[model samples]
Target chain A: MIELAGVTKSFGANRVLAGVDLSVGRGRSLVVIGGSGTGKSVLLKCILGLEAPDAGRITVDGRDAATGDREAFLACFGMLFQGGALFDSLPVWQNVSFRLLRGALKRPRAEAREIAIEKLRRVGLSPDVADKVPAELSGGMQKRVGLARAIAADPQIIFFDEPTTGLDPIMSGVINDLIREIVSEMGATALTITHDMTSVRAIADEVAMLHGGVIRWTGPVAALDASGDPYVDQFIHGRAEGPIAALR
Target chain B: MRLPLSLLAALGAAVLSGLAAVGRVTLFALATFRHMLSPPFYGREFLVALGNVGWLSLPVVGLTAFFTGGALALQIYAGGARFDAQAVVPQIVALGMVRELGPVLVGLMIAARVTSSIAAEIATMKVTEQIDALVTLSTHPMKYLTVPRVLAGIVAVPLLVGLGDIIGIFGGFTVGVQSLGFNPSVYIRNTWDFLEPLDVISSLVKGLAFGFIATLMGCYAGMRSGRGAQGVGRATKASVEGASVLILAANFLLTGVFFSL
Candidate 1:
């Protein structure tokens, strides 16, 4: 399980996460939904220890997340960034197998490549694409490659940031299905941050809506529609004129 | 009263910001050095950086040194005629190339070439979130990106400067023998006999300092860059400017320390 209490972060004068408290149970999928610029990414980064919280405690599986050996703690977690941030210089297989090829997880180059190719296949990519660089892939392919990389080491925990952000509806559906299938098969603890309702409905076991740097509502995926909160209601229906003021 | 006060405020603000930028770069350089000494060093990355900064730079450094040396020989010949000291051409050229021009010119070229390239590549990586991806993949961006390049600069640029000094003096020799009415054997001997080991060493040291400054500025500017294409462009420009100014300043300091007498 992962937990955060009073997690706060700010960039210069602009406060992003303000005294936020949230958690995800082990072996469960939690999707944190929020609109643009609502600190969804910041919240996720804080959990990953990528951004230090001004005042907060984050614990994973009953241990302080930031207190342990960073490599060991991080080895258990897999993350897919919003932009499919693959290493531009490396081939697709190298990108997928990066962790395996270096540091404490170092393996033979050929073995790492073989595993990378296997993961690529798991993500619905052919072996032929393994030698190509990330630039050679399309938007959807890049995301899949990123997904393959996330699961390459068989991490026990996975975080997907905007998994279906820029794809077409068909591609989004395909990605959502892949995410769902992978999570189920691996039984990994999953935390996803996205504004996509379809993605939430498809992958989430529970849902948390973040707004104004706090969890506005939390419930099961099925109960999201009838949560009865005005902000939740305003958000789900996509109404412009609502309690949630639009950005200029 | 308002005008003067506002102008003062603006001046103060600029000064404060410049100080802050210096502080940031200093901290960044320290961090890079710290990571370089720690475990899990990236040898492949270091090798690649060396190749890019040292080997690939030979052609341009060689070409620039060659032309500068040729021009200096010509200028020395023309100016020395009035004083009847035209025979000092080889010695002057040797001293000029070995002690000052070789390091400075190579430093500037690195500022233009390597520093700009580092800033652009890293800024683009920052824009694209590749740095963040690196973090996720259990890597320090500094160790992977900055340390290797900076260390390479320290290692490779000295060699480049030494090569540049030799090539530059050779350029003078070529011009002196072919164009000027000078004895080839005496000209070569004058170039060789007049050069001190200290001069060559000082030139290499200047190269090291300039290389460090150029590369550190690039990485610092790039890592701190804002989002988008415009941000990357601005970072690249700032890197080159910072590198050029720092190289020149360092050149002066190194010269003073090396030749105080």
Candidate 2:
């Protein structure tokens, strides 16, 4: 389980995340939904230790995020960055097996390559695509490659950051299905942030809404529509005139 | 009154920002040194850096050395002739190339090529969140990225300077014997006799110092680069500028220390 309590972050005069309290139980998928600039990305970054919250405590499985060996802690989690963030210099197989090729999780080169190709196959990529670089692939293909890398280590925790943001609707559905399947099969703790309603329906067991730097509403997917919160209703139904006003 | 006050404020801001940048770079250099000495070293990345910064740089360094040597020989001959002192041409050219021009010119060239490239590549990685990805992969950016390149510069550049010195003197010798109607044996003997061991040592030392400054500036600017294409452009420009200027300044100080005594 991952828990964040009273997490607040600010940049200069702009407060992005203000005392956000949220939790996801073990092996559950939580999709955080929000409009642009509402601190969804910042919240993920804070939990990932990429960005430190000014005032908060985050714990993973009962220990503080800041304690213990950093590398050992990181090894337990896998993340798919929003932009795919694949190393342009490396080919697809190398990118997928990056961690396994070195460090404590180091495996034999041949074994690592085989595993990478296997993971690639799991994400619907052919073995022939293994040698091609990230630049050679299309955006959707790159996202799939990113997904392959995230699951490459067979991590206990997986983070999907805007996984379906730029894909076509069909590709988006494919990716959404992939995420759902991967989470279910691995029984991994999954945290995702996206505004795609389709993705919310397909990927989430639970939903949390972030608005104005706080969790305005959080409940099960079934309870999202009838939660009786105006902000939640306004956001889910995509209504502009309600309490959660869209910025002009 | 208003114009002068605004100008004063602008000057003050520039000075403050400049100092801040210097402070940050100094701290970065210290951290790079620390990481380079520590374990969990990435051997493959180190080898790649050596090939990229050292071996690949040879052709450009050789060409530059060859042309500079020839020019130096011609210039010294022309100037020396005014006082019937043209015999000193070989000695002057040897000393000049070995002690100063070769290492300094090579350093600036690296600043122009290697430094800008490192900054641009790293800044692009940062913009793409690749650096953050490395962090998530449990790799320190300084260890995985900065240390290998900086260490390569420290090791490869001295060898390059030594090679450049030799090639440049050969250029001088070719021009001295073939173009200037000088005796080959006498010119060669003069160059051989006039150069002290200290001169060669000083050149290599300068090479190491210049290399460190050049590569360090690149990594520093890159890691701190702002977002967007404009940010990347600024980082590249700043890296080259910082590396070139610092290399020149260090060269002057090194010359003073090596030869003054």
Candidate 3:
């Protein structure tokens, strides 16, 4: 379980997160939806301890997450970035088993490589792709590689940041299904931040809408369509006639 | 009155912000150093960094030292002809290469090439969210990225500087024998006699310090890069400029410290 209470963050004069509170239960998928620059990413970063909250507490698994041995706290979670940020210099297998190949978890190079390849296979990538660098893979393949790496250590919690941002609809659907399957099979707490309705529908057990640095609505996935909040309605229907103004 | 008040306010804010930023960055550096000393040392990453910072850098370092040494010899010989002090050519070349020219030139070359490369690569990664990916994977960006590269720079630069000094002295020797009509044996002897151990040691020390500054500034600028294409470009530019300036400043301070004693 994860809980964030009254978290606030500011960059210079612009306050990105303002007294935001949220919680996600274990073995549940919570998706945060918001338009660009709405602090959805900042909320995730705050929970991950990448960005320190100015005012409040974040607890992961009932432990204070904001201050402590951050490495140990982070070890319990995995993240899949929007851009599928695989290390360009390393081959797919090395990238996947990066954590396992290091200290405390150190295995022989061959054993680490074998584990990496197994994870890749789980993500629908072939053994042939294991030796290839990230630059050689297509966008969809890279996202799979990123996903494989995320699940390599069998983390208790997983964070997905815009898992379908740049992919085609088919690829997005594939990724969304993969995320759902992984979350269900592992029974891991999943938190995803994205604007894509399809992704939310496919992966979220619960949905939260972020606006003005605070969650405007939180309910089961089914309630998103009928939430009746003007902002939620405006955002979900993609209508220009509502309170949300077009950038033009 | 409005302009003056605004200016004062801006100045005050700038000072405070600068101090805050420095404090934050210092904390980040300390954390990185601590992680480096702790377990989970990424040997593969370290090896890759060594290859990047050491082996790959040799060609540029060698070429720069060689050309600079040859040029220095030519210039010294030309200047010495007027005073009929041509016998000082070998000694001056050796002193220049070991004491100042080799380290400074190699440092500048690295600042130009390696610093910009690291900055641009990391800034692009930042813009693309790669650093965040590392953070999310339970990897400390400081440990995974900055530590290996910074540690490699510390280990590799001194070796490169020593190599540069050798190449540079040889360059001067080549010019002295082939171009200046000097006895090769006598020139080598004079060069050896003029160089003190202190000069070589100073060069190595300067190299290590400059290398640390170059890579640290690069990583700092890259990690702090904002989102988008323009942000990455700005970060790259800032990194190169910052690294170059820091290297020169550090070189001066290191030289002063070494000679002051």
Candidate 4:
């Protein structure tokens, strides 16, 4: 479980996140829907303590995220960045087993490689792709490798930032399905940020719309259609003329 | 009056920003040292950096030293002839190359080569979010990336400087014997006898300082880079610029410290 209370962050004169209070229950999949530059990524970064919020607190399973052993705290969660963020210098297997190759979770090299191959398989990749660098893989394949990495450690929680941003519709669907399956199978608490409606329908157990640095609406996925909030309505319908302004 | 005030204001702002950059770099360097002294040492990364900053740099350092040494010999011979001091070629060349040029040239070469490369690579990593990924994976970026490269520069560049000094002396010897019509045995003996331990020590010390400056500037510029391809370009440019200027400045300060004291 994750909790954020009265979280606010500002950059220069621009307030990216203003008084954000959000939480995700244990083992639930919460997908945040926001337009570009809506501070969705900032919210995730704040939760992970990657970016410090100006005010308020964030906690995971009751411990303040800002305090405690950083390495131990971070060990509980895995993140798949918007870009794959795979180490270009490393082979795909090394990237996937990065956590296992060092730090407190380190395993022997042979064992780490075996786990990387297994996780790659879980994400629909074969063993042959293991030795190749991330640059040699296609975009979709790279995304798959990233997913494999996120789940490789079997983390208690996983954060997906724009998991299907640049993929085609079919590939996006495949990624969404893979995410849904992995989160369910692992029983991991999942938090994802995306603007894709198709991805939301496919992956989200609960949906929250972010606009004007605040959560406009939040409910079960079934209620997304009839949320009755103007901002959510405008966003889900993709209407040019609505309460939500088009030009960011 | 307004024009002068505006100029003053611009100069003040430049000074302030420069001071801020210096402060940031100082803090970053201190943090890198802290990480270097701590545990979970990344020996593998350090070895890779050693190869990059040391072995891969041999050809360029050697070639630059060789050509510079040859040119210096010719210049000394030509200039000394006017004063009837052409016989002083071996002594001057030995002192000049060992005491100054060897370390300075190698430092500049590393600034141009390794500094630019490290900045570009790390800046690209920052842009692509690999740095954030490293953080999320529970790895300290400073521990994983900066310490190894900085340590390598500290460990390797001095040795390179020593090798460059030797190669440069040999180059001067070659020119002195074959080109300048000087006796080979006399040139060799003169070059050897003219050098002192202080000159060698000073050269190695300059190498140590210059190496630290080059790699530190590269890592500093890179970690502070902005986003996108333009950011990467700027980081690479700033790294080489910073490394070159700092190496030269360090060379001057170090020279005064060694020779003056």
DockQ of each: 0.77, 0.89, 0.64, 0.95
**What TM value does chain A in model 1 reach?**
0.98
Question: Tens-digit lDDT track for model 3 on B104-203?
Answer: 8888887787777787888888887788777766677777788888888888888999999999989988999999999999999998888888888999
For model 1, the superposed segments whose C-alpha errors exceed 4 Å read none
Clashes of 1: 0
Ten contiguous residues with the weakest lDDT in model 1 chain B:
B252-261
> In lDDT terms, how accurate is model 2?
0.93
Best by lDDT: 4
* Model 2 Cα lDDT, one tens digit per residue, A161-212: 9999889999999999999999999999999999888999999999999998
TM-score of chain B of 3: 0.92
The TM-scores, chain A only, for the candidates as listed are 0.98, 0.98, 0.97, 0.99
lDDT for B57 in candidate 2 is: 90
**What is the iRMSD of the candidate numbered 2?**
0.6
Off by over 4 Å in 3: B1-36, B258-261
User: How do these models rank on lDDT, best leading?
Assistant: 4, 2, 1, 3
Worst 10 residues of 1 chain A by lDDT: A239-248
Instruction: Score every model by TM-score.
Output: 0.97, 0.97, 0.92, 0.99
Write down the worst ten-residue block by lDDT for model 4 chain A: A209-218
For candidate 3 chain B, which ten residues in a row score worst on lDDT?
Answer: B24-33
Give the Cα-based TM-score of candidate 1 against the true structure.
Answer: 0.97
Could you tell me how far off, in angstroms, the CA of residue B185 lies in candidate 2 after the best superposition? 2.9
Report the C-alpha displacement of residue B161, candidate 2, in angstroms: 1.1
